[model samples]
Target: MSSIQSPKKGTHSVGVARQYSGTAGRIENCQVGVFAAYASRWGQALIDRQLYLPKSWAGDPARRDSAQVPDEVAFATKPAMACEMIARLLDEGTPCAFVLADAVYGSDHSFRRMLEARGQAYVLAVRSNHTLRFLEDWSLVQTDPGTMIADLPAETWTPLSAGEGAKGPRLYHWARLPLKYQAGQGFSLWFLARRSLRDPGAIAYYFAYAPSDATLEDLAAAAGLRWAIEECFLRAKDDLGLDHCEARSWHGWHRHMSLVMAAAAFLARIGADQRRAAYGKQNETSPKRPAA
Candidate 1:
């Protein structure tokens, strides 16, 4: 579970300023927080993070001095940072199924391309205005929403649940539009849409690259995993002091974040063990059905 935000600041705190969309529209301040979290049926937890440093702060020695930014702190675009993390984690034998993120990473063409090249699949969120390409005579041509999945017939939409939520299974009407490109030996591209059952006019979109045999249920499951990242962020901050960093230097900030993630991971492991134990007990006490 991973997400990014500009942390709140007080007079004495050292924070990196970044733009955020809030009630005020867009605001900037001195804090950038990016994190990675682990999620599963038993529990979810934030496990890692990369603090964002703005270009302004990175290039200015004077600004760095005031903030006590470490000499090693360097500029890294959000997409690049995300790519690095994903690749490194996968390389380290992390059980990555499909990459999932909000529009920030989804809109990054290079990031999507990178994933394709690596033979990794992803179901990434995107804005309404993103373009798509159409396959024609074995060639791809730049096109509009037809390629972007806008003009689908009413019957194309299917009701599906991305995953379970706080109340129950999260349901939405889903439709998939095939893309011009085949990702690779094991990949395929498509534009996935989710419409509200009550308000069909309201729609959300995602761009997905998955295996040729991947079903809509598989893509929906990956899309639903994005929700876990948000939940991980909230629980970590509330229970594990995730945003309580007081560090003014790069090392200090990372150290604080790492410690918080460690705590969260520890708790998640304990929670998983407890759930497994309870599940075992339930099985033991339940009456067995007669053999057929």
Candidate 2:
């Protein structure tokens, strides 16, 4: 989810309020939109979006009517909007490998439960001080992530590259610890931690639910995929004028966002096709060795 900051704080535009804007890295007069993106090895593009209606606007009938908010549209949390989008994706049989999200969604119990109830695998970031539970010597032990990681031995940390970035491989020391509670018979929960090699104190926490056989590397990779959504937001805003909406009505904002997402999907398809063509050409030009 991301927010588009508005130039003026006037009470005209729909969903515009003084709120947290990730783009600005601070609270500003903006409209927040919860978006769902489909990402894979081939390409990534936004598939769904929901404009957040704050309680103030939802309770005000005058504002609702002025902004043309539908009668069925009610106030919903960002995580709830995300869950609805994901449910639609799954119902439509959209191919998905793993769900990835940041602390905003990860810290919500209902949001996490919704994903687990559907038997979906996910790796979600959480706060360093987030509470955690695990089994030790046939006993359930409760602790926060920071305390748990601090108690681990140095040998437990495994250095690995999460994925390639603009600079090079995004290297970090990662570790995973099994949780006591299971999502289901075959599913497992884990507490995953990552720390930067340059600054060990720069650490992040994640909670993952996946198959029991899932490796630390798999969880790390899933965690890294969260960047895909951010990249989508970046490309859409910079290239497609995603945040340039001047609409005051709710329907107007939705219409603009929908059109922008369509354009982004089209661009992503073209990029993927070009990449495949280049790969095929390289293979065709290379000499093949004779089989023995």
Candidate 3:
């Protein structure tokens, strides 16, 4: 997770610093921030989802040189770019249970297509205005959309429960729709009734993809897994001070942020080791007194 911030007061003036300007003295006024995160999730014992900080957020207008920074590379905002990132990681043999993301990444159709193409499964949160179709037999209909293609029949949908106990109520309604957007291609469309957990009655639409055999229960579980990303963001911001660094230069900002991520990783490792030691001690002490 990454965030960009500009000066609150006024725009920065562009000029060349006297010390560095030997041949041509020109400094471009711009906004700047750090894109700090680990590239892989191995140390955390979680899925192989890396924390990518895209360059566009740092006030790079053209987003051309974003990927040039090897430590903190730029990512394409397009859905296909997201797909490419995942594909590269998977190709490198990163193991993961499922892909999870928020609505911003989830809404990208191309990204979804790429995930499916790789035989990868995901549970993503979508916005309230997404489109969907229901599963149904379309062979007998006069308009056959072709193989893997079917149309959802109009029907009244039902509200479904989201999340388990103590996490607060994140409820939604869903319908498993059949869709055929292109010729000779079709897939199951999961339509979800969108409503904020804070406001129960408010309704909207969200979409998802799954195999024909995917059950309602499976979809619900997949959607819930998206919360893991939320947990990641919270830890990054609150625990690691993700948005509080005060570096002015591009390189300086990233270097500082990388330190923070390294610290967090170190702490996580220490905590795990401590837990194992405590458990080992407990096992050693618990049953010995009875025999004596």
> Across residues 200-257, which tens digit of lDDT does each residue of candidate 1 receive?
7688788889988999888878888888888777777789776677777767878888
Which residue segments of model 3 deviate by more than 4 Å?
1-75, 78-81, 130-161, 165-174, 181-189, 194-200, 266-292
Most lDDT-accurate candidate: 2
Q: What are the lDDT figures for the candidates, one per model?
A: 0.76, 0.86, 0.47
The true-structure Cα RMSD of candidate 1 reads 2.9
Candidate 2 colliding pairs = none
TM-score of each: 0.88, 0.92, 0.55
Best of the candidates, TM-score: 2
Tens-digit lDDT string for candidate 2 (1-292): 3334444468789988888877678888888888888888777999888889989898999999999999999998888888888889999999877888888888888888988999999888889877766678989887898998999999999998888799998999999988777577689999899999999999999889999988899988888878988899889989999988889999899999999999999999999888877764536558886789
Candidate 3, residue 120: Cα displacement in angstroms equals 1.5
Off by over 4 Å in 2: 1-8, 133-142, 280-288
lDDT of 1 at 84: 80
Q: Candidate 1: count the clashes.
A: 7
Model 2 residue 154 lDDT? 94
